[model samples]
Target: MRTKIILTATVLIGGAAFAIAQTSHTGHSDGMDHSAHQQEQAMTGAALSEPGQGAFAALSELVRVLEADPNTDWAQVDLAGLRAHLVDMDRLVMDAVVIETDLPDGISAIATGDADTIATLRRMVPAHAAQLARDDRWTVDATETNDGIELRVTSEIPAVVARIKGLGFFGLMASQDHHREHHFMMAQGKDAHGH
Candidate 1:
């Protein structure tokens, strides 16, 4: 009987404490609302505070167009800068293969060939392939005119196959994530020391 009475008192005290805590925190449980914060950010021009301001600006414009007109044809929109960047990226990958011969190679080549060039080629080709895959400018389509040699995005725009079609090279030979990381870091604002 004594133990039961003591246990009932403890439960009553604990329940009262929990009720007080709930009443005290009733109006403040949700904390800061992020959607409202984002709205304020948009109002005060904090939306474009990132280092890639131009890219963000372009994205904002695209968003605005889509929001204003649901039927907006984004492909027909004037994305000159975006298009130029895409084209430049594609051309860079295609050109990366040209400088491949300067790399080093081991005893894998034929009787007469520069080993360094072979090595460089082996490294660069994979990098080129990865870049080509990521480049959104050139779309990969099936109805290409040249079988396995050329890739067609549309009826008008055509580019060469990315996988070294004649040489049978299909995948990246070295790490390509580093290249992506480097590009992303470069896109960000420079440090105080211009790094």
Candidate 2:
């Protein structure tokens, strides 16, 4: 019964979000801006949620979350930063090139791309490497090379080593679940990477 209720709620919310997208999406050319806030205001039947695109959906969700919070300082809110970060994420996943070297216990790679992708990679990999380093299961290192960013990840446990090797650099980057919190903070004009 509880499962059915949860599933029903999910379906209803999804339907509402779709209706909102069909009604509201204008096919903007660039990143999401303050228009998301306007979209938030334009909601109908409390059904308007999640814009058509992934980044827009994420931004809109945060806008809703922040707006609902009692202490949110609108003056300090910086959805632009979050939008920029989301663009960086797209670049990292879609554009960056990973040159992998398989290791006995793990893997190493020099992640490279065009100028913009390289810049995003340099900023992102090291920060995430720092995050990965804190985990006892793996030893992670990221260093800047002339052409790209070099990532080395290894593990002490045999099972973990196999997992690390399988994950490789890109998968390793996707391992830690920090992007959501970082997005919220970035949207609030704060640097989660402190960079």
Worst 10 residues of 2 by lDDT: 23-32
* Model 2, residue 141: C-alpha shift (Å): 0.5
- TM-scores, all candidates, are 0.20, 0.74
Residues 108-179 of candidate 1 have per-residue lDDT tens digits of 111112343333334333335445456454333211111112222211222233223222222232223444
Cα lDDT of all candidates, in order?
0.39, 0.86
Evaluate model 2: give its TM-score. Answer: 0.74
Superposition error at 42 for model 2 (Å): 14
Question: How far does residue 178 in candidate 1 sit from its true spot (Å)?
Answer: 29
Task: Give me the runs in candidate 1 sitting further than 4 Å from their true place.
Answer: 1-34, 42-60, 70-195
Candidates' RMSD to native: 17.6, 10.5
Task: Give the Cα RMSD of candidate 2.
Answer: 10.5
